[model samples]
Target: MFKTLADWLAFDVFGLTAESSMGESVHFFIMDITKIFFMLVTIIYIMGLFRSFVSPEKVRTYIQGKSKFAARVLAIVLGAVTPFCSCSSVPLFIGFVEAGIPLGVTFSFLIASPMINEIAVVMLWGMVGWKITALYVASGMVVAFFGGIIMEKFKPERWVEDYVWKIQMGEVQAIEQDNSLPARHRYAFGEVKEIVGRIWKWVIVGVGLGALFHGYFPENWAASLGDANNWLAVPMSVLIGVPLYSNAVGVIPLAEAMLLKGVALGTTLSFMMSIAAISLPELLILRKVIQWQALALFTAIVTVSIMLVGWFFNIIV
Candidate 1:
């Protein structure tokens, strides 16, 4: 159905020859945009519904005072589900610290929240194959879990800002209350609209870039740089991705384009993870709460963990 609609728009309505390059690019663009937006609306709505049942306070309470292993695990899981982005980092960090959730546990949640969002998972599953999607999620969870543990071992409490320690959230209350099923669904719909409105343009830009690469860019150059035997490919991709910021939804199309142009699975995934998890903007947000030394340590831990995941997947996949 999607292909047919794209075909009609590109060939019949746009008057482009079906076999021409422009025609193909337009069709691919339209098809991808249609499919992605559909998936985004449906999946995000469902995720929002699930998110309604959980609150940051609940997560903080659950992780507080748990065994190290349990706390780390729970933090990672909650991070995966919580609707957090880089913009929320400072406030969430403060809340976690004030609630007595360990720094490492909070870091685990922070790492997983952006890197493994439901939108990213669904897009990966829809755009790539299930095996790759599964690998991405598993690798992300591993990175979050181990990264948090490594930071915990370093004990960087002294690096936190004095103001962050002084500021306290007293008498935490659950942010959301139980509502009728219809009300919850209505709230979910609003969430879906807000999220889609926020990222839809990026989604288009990503898909347009992918379409251009698919139709115009020379494959040979990309293949040479992304050569599987080149050990540098993964690290290079990570380095390139870290400085830029884009959500998983925005990056998926570009990732798909790179993969189709012969990038190694590990290299492409590493790039995507870096973009989602460790952008410059996120670092700026963290700087508000952490000293330079702690920030550097956090960055190092995440970068190393991501690189390790890339190399492992490169070998196994």
Candidate 2:
């Protein structure tokens, strides 16, 4: 059954009969649509659940201690398992700062949550190897933790707008006004609404781009990027990816397409990491909440970290 379906959805004229190509193209398109539909619904349901049980208040109460470095590390580990966006983490960021959790610690969570999200890592595991995926996740956490540490040491509180400080110190009233619903339903809806709202557009765009790549990328793209003698794929891809931002699920199809087209593993990985971790959206949004210096520092740190990750995997994988 699976073989038949694969044949129906992924036919190549050179590899299969004409009848199979027509059937497979239709099948592949349908599968793509189906994946998007289900993923959206699931994200909504999960986001709602998250809204019910967790909040800035709760997170603030828990994020304390002399072991801040360890705390930051823990946040990264836990964050990678979570499926949330960089914007949605604002509340937690506020909560941490309010709770006296320290600046670096808060940044740690912010960094890890968006960059090393579950969707990205899971996709990587399916497309790459466990070792590469593990490294990706690990490096993301380190970027957040170390980035936060560096920012904290520099003390960018002066750079933060007075408005963010005000919002951080107290209730963000806007997110709170909808307290009329039942707790369970409210939490579930909150999770879905917040997560889905932020990621939905990116998913659509990313998925469409990915599907295009999957369907049409020429062969030999990988060899061009992966050839060890050409070490620029990692940094070059990262630079190119800075303007783009797409979630893991949205980009996976593209990654698969790139592989099929012959894009180097190192270049592809770097590109994906840049899209996931260092996109223009993240930076622009972050500017509203953080100072220019902190934002620049954050971008620089993550960029270096991703490049390093790319280089390391290039050699090993």
Candidate 3:
């Protein structure tokens, strides 16, 4: 249905030849932008209804009370559900700490928040398939789960900035929320508005890049990266992605294009994860809460873990 609409607009209405690169790119862009925004509004609103039941303070209290494994699991799950980006890192990190959540478990939430989310999952399912989406979600969980455990082993608390420790976190008073149907609907609408407003530009940029790659990138050049012998592709993808800042919403379209153009599955996954998870902007924000040492360690652990995930997928799939 979307393809038909895009084709009409691009080829019939605009009168561009279907064979032309500009026509194809225009179609790709139109189709994706329309489909993505429609899905985002509908789905995010639904998710927002459930989100009203969960708050950051509540999450912190729950994690603080759970066992080690449970805390890690909860953290990862919450991270995936929350619509947080790197911009929220500093305050979220501080809130977790101030709430007395374990450093390791806190690390898990931090890792998963930007790297994996409902929007990304839905977008991937639409662009790729459930099989690849499952793989992506599984890999993200594993990285967050283990990354937290490893950071705990490093005695990460010692590396936190002195200011964080000095600042006292007072007890939070829980406020009752309205759970009436109308209120829930209002919350859902607000979420749709806020989330769509925040990420719509990213969706445009992402789809634009995807369209360009789909229409103009050399197929043979892209295929070369898929070669089994190209071991460096995984690490190189990670390295390149680290400095770039984007949420999963922005990166998924580019990832879809790479896969369509013959980039190796694992390499593409690595690039996507690195761009969403370990962006330099995120690290710079984290610097305010943690010292240089902790920041370096966080970067190293996530980078290495992402690289491993890439190589592992390359080997198996």
Candidate 4:
């Protein structure tokens, strides 16, 4: 009975034949669907752990009276750890303002939090090489740091909400823990459900985008991008990626597909970083934090940094 059941479980339900084109199409569709589901479950679950475990409020207190440079460095480190989203960015921005951190320093944390979190790094490492993955983290942090500095030079105090100046200082609330084993388990499960539930749509969208690139795009895309022939790919890719927004997990599959399709590594990396850092989603969300002028400065700084990253990576790799 055990042997028979094992055989049954191993059998393909759709009866796709290995040698047939029709069977191959079915298999591809099934695999893409599975990947989409996996991306949703994995990405959001990780974010849930971040929400439940890490506290950005704690970070806000430490930057008090510190050098902007130090805060920027800390921002990069914090950004790597915190699981902030578009919704959360505002409160954090408010917290920074209430704390009297430099304008640029505040921008540093705000910029870093959503663009390059730990979840993205882990996903990048899993999907791409450690070298490329490391580059993503390092460059993202630098972008956040300098991007904030550039924004500070403009000094858009008018962009801040009038109410932020009146906010009284207070400690941030920490996550609650349960003493009972069952309750602890429930808390963990709840985190997963909450995180995954929110961004699951993005999973389907991202994987679907990746699948399109995988199935239909020219096979030589990455290779052509990878080749050092034209210097034009760097700026062109950056120009294209600016209005797009993708979390690291979403972009990893796209990057894999691009690489498979002969997309240039530098160009692809630039595109991924631009979408992650300087995209429309971030801009729209940032509008709630700072006015249009500041937002433009922020975008310009991030775009230039990403463009440089693309060119630098292309030259080195």
On TM-score, the candidate that comes out on top is: 3
lDDT, candidate 1, at 167: 94
What's the true lDDT of residue 247 in model 4?
64
Per-residue lDDT for 201-236 in model 1, tens only? 889988997888766777786887577778798889
Question: What is candidate 1's CA lDDT for residue 93?
Answer: 92
TM-score of each candidate structure, all chains considered together: 0.93, 0.75, 0.93, 0.83
Which candidate wins on lDDT? 3
Decoy 4 TM-score against native:
0.83
Candidate 3 off by > 4 Å? 85-88
- Candidate lDDT (C-alpha), each: 0.85, 0.65, 0.86, 0.70
State the lDDT at 317 in candidate 4.
Answer: 77
Candidate 2, residues 186-281, lDDT tens digits: the string is: 666666676567666766676566555555544356567767557888898888786676766666656655655667666676677777776666
How far is 220's C-alpha from truth in model 1 (Å)?
1.1
Q: Which tens-of-lDDT digit does each residue in 184-212 have in candidate 4?
A: 55665786687666755655566667756
Candidate 3 colliding pairs: none
